[model samples]
Target chain A: MILDGKALSNQLDVNMKAEVAELKATGLSPKLVVIIVGHDPASQIYVHNKHRKAIKLGIESIIERREADFTEAELLQLIDQYNCDDSVHGILVQLPLPKHIDEGKIIRAIDVHKDVDGFSPESVGKLFNNSHEHYPVSCTPKGIMTMLSHYHIDPKGQHAVIVGDSNIVGRPMGALLLNAGATVTYTHILTENLSAHTKTADILIVATGVAHLIKAADIKPGATVIDVGMDRDENGKLVGDVDYDHAKDVAGAITPVPGGVGPMTITTLMQQTIELAKVADHRTLQPVR
Target chain B: MILDGKALSNQLDVNMKAEVAELKATGLSPKLVVIIVGHDPASQIYVHNKHRKAIKLGIESIIERREADFTEAELLQLIDQYNCDDSVHGILVQLPLPKHIDEGKIIRAIDVHKDVDGFSPESVGKLFNNSHEHYPVSCTPKGIMTMLSHYHIDPKGQHAVIVGDSNIVGRPMGALLLNAGATVTYTHILTENLSAHTKTADILIVATGVAHLIKAADIKPGATVIDVGMDRDENGKLVGDVDYDHAKDVAGAITPVPGGVGPMTITTLMQQTIELAKVADHRTLQPVR
Candidate 1:
């Protein structure tokens, strides 16, 4: 069965709507500040979608538009402003910012409580320490688990192999899978005999934007596959790192590009927004164990 | 060959003492603050050993003696007092503080910069995130790696099965091994068929304080075993988690309980103290790493 992220996100949106309505009744709507640097077409599309989603969920989202060449000083200035803004419940700066600005610097600049992207070392550290007191998990990966559950993929005791070592997708992905009780292996280019590890994985997640890096032969039969890549293949069409056309035949479950993980990324973001709103309201969304 | 940590720690002090001389040439001595909160005889003995080691190496040592019934406010106040004191390079509040004090609360109070025990959630989180900035690693696992290298027992590409899940030993040990390019399987009480994982490990580190928990029957022949357990067997003799008499006959290398992990634990704290002091001077120490 395919993991329907759009369906999951829709269901999640309804729950968030109720949460936002409750916050509205208290005369304080959840507010989010999204800073997008540059005129990147993809970033524009993302910001627009996020704004629309927040509005539909009764959230107040203020988009702080900045130039592609925004100075580090300017970017941090906006972040400091958001950090102090009582009106801003969450803060996210669109990633892949211009090369001049240290992405980590800006990410860490946001107060730990306000960093919704969860990329700050402080935020990432909390996830590691299991002290996530109001920590916002990365939307894409959190969405991956949500999608996995939607398709009923219980990772417990399974061998989960992630074919990337990126801090964003690979490392945290391994941590998440490990937390779920899966025997996790983080494989990278440095790892000798990559196929030897991949073929044994009960769940295979490929996030290296190297197009067609993972094919049907790289996966175990009846394994679950998650593709978290967006890159162009030889045909110049957006394809995942996986050779999905044939992989679907061998895999028990899979996520498709554009429809699978795409919708859930922002959907998880909005959900975190509502969750953060509840936290700011001095109410607990889930009891701390 | 027993991977003797007592011998290793002694050898390390000789090496680190020479490094400390160089460090003193620059007019700064690696300093450690050993805080004991109770009159626990065992804790007193451990603190005394650490204090003696630090003095022998030309390192500055401060023993902050506090009563068993100290108030939470007073303990936190002591922690805060050290947070500002520049002479204090490392802070170690002895474990198992009196019952009235919440260990978790006290653990959080230690400044992450001076958290030599590396038990603070911040340090643990940073270790988990693979970010090694200004954070002290937990001592015992660092000592385990030191023992591995001193004995030429490199864990790279090997399967490491650690039997225990305590924050002090098993969990961080798994993270440390994985960071060094090993396939680590962390087993706790909930893990089914404990020996199944242990038997496959090329290197096994048994840290569950249960005496004689691991026997020769549970380990693969020629596997390296590092016993972190310091429990007394039924006969009232000190023994490690592994039964040495049976284990030594089969295992390629093992560490004895009395002379194994115990000595290195204090040595690691001293090494980190020197390392942190050098770090403060914009230099890095190469002896341990």
Candidate 2:
């Protein structure tokens, strides 16, 4: 069975649209400010899609675009402006800034309350510790968890292998799985005998950008496979890390490349934006004696 | 081969003691403040041991004893006092606080600069993210990493299985190994066929606190095992999570219950206290024109 993320994302958007209308009725506008520095082509497409989704869901989306030569100080000043604005519920600075800009400093500059991208150290810490609090996580991993829940694929007592050690996806993804009671193994580029580990997984999550890294023989029969890769083949066709055409025959369930994780990530971002807005309003809307 | 954490700790202390003396000569007195709020016998012993170790290393140690009935507000006030003091380099609140006191609040109350115990969310985030910046970590796991490095048991390209899920030990231990380039697996009570996972580990770290939870048959021959449990056996004797009497024979190298991880924990605490003091002083000790 294929995990249809695009269909699920559309279904979720309908509910979110109603949620946004209700929130606005209560005088709370769910607003997100995305600050993108430089004109990286891929990042531009991502920003465009997010803005389109927010408008469709009735959420306020603001894209603050700057030139490639924008100073790090200027970017930080812009972030401070949105951070101090009570109406802005979420603030996200698109990553891979210019060489002159320090990414870590820029990430740390955003207020934790408005950290919708959930790339801040505080959010990462909360996720890893499995803190019993409402904290945002990297959208890709969080969206995968949502898809798993929708499909009733319980990770409890299962051996889940994460094939990548990226801070955004693989590390947080493993932590979420571990918190859900799955025995999670994290393998990276330095890992030895990758196939030996992947074959033992009851659930396999492949996030490495390497094209078709895991073949059909590397998969465990009946395992739930989640491919997070959006790599291009030699012929310039987009594909996942797993050889899905053959691995799908052996795997019990899987997510495809373009229509699977991509839509869900944007959907999760919008969901978190609305959630943060409600939380922010709740603090201010407290009844006084 | 035995991983003699006691010997390595004593060896490390010789160098730390000298380092402390040199800092003191430079008008910087490295000091640690440990606060114990209740009469938990185990916590008392742990606190006493830490104090003794600090004094022996030529570092100033202060013990703040409070009544079991002390209010959480009073405890917070005491932490604030230390947090404001420039003389204090590290603040530690012994765990298992009174039923009325909130542990998370207390942990966060300590200034991150003086968080010697490294329980703050920021430090944990840094550890998980493999941040390049210098940061303290939970003493136990940090101690294990020191032991691994001292013994030349490089974790790179190895499969390391952690058989517990406690925030202090198992979780951070896996993160440390993952940062060291090892493939890390985290297993807990909900893990099915736990032995099946342990058998594949090149480096197995067991900290479940369950007496004799892992036996010789459960281990892989020639695997390096580090047992972090401090459990009492059926006979009321000190033991570890692993059945060391028989399992030691199957393991290629292992750490014993009393002399292994135990000594190293105190050693790492003292090491970090001095390091934090130096870091704190470095920021204030700038040269003027």
Over A1-289, each residue of candidate 1 has an lDDT whose tens digit, in order, gives 6766778888988988887888789776888999999988988999999999999988998999998888999998889988898878899998789999987677778887777777776566555555636577788877888788777788877877888767777777766666676766667665666777788778898988899898899889999999988889788999888888999898889888757788888888887777776777787677321
The TM-score obtained for chain B of candidate 1 when compared with the true chain B: 0.95
lDDT of 2 at A277: 91
Docking class of 1: acceptable
Model 1 is docked with a DockQ of 0.35
Model 2: CA > 4 A from native:
A283-289, B283-289
Candidate 1: tens digits of C-alpha lDDT, residues B1-289: 9777877788889988998898788788778888898799888999999999999998999999988788988999998998888888888889888888888788878777788888876677667666646667889998998889888887777877888766788778877887787766666665556786688778898988899999899999999998999898788989889999999998888898799888999899898888778776778656334
Q: How well does candidate 1 score on lDDT at residue A194?
A: 74
- Alpha-carbon error at A132 in model 2, in Å? 1.1
Evaluate model 1: give its lDDT: 0.81
DockQ metric for all predictions:
0.35, 0.80
- Show where candidate 1 strays beyond 4 Å: A39-45, A149-159, A180-182, A193-204, A210-223, A242-252, B39-41, B151-158, B193-196, B212-223, B243-253, B281-289
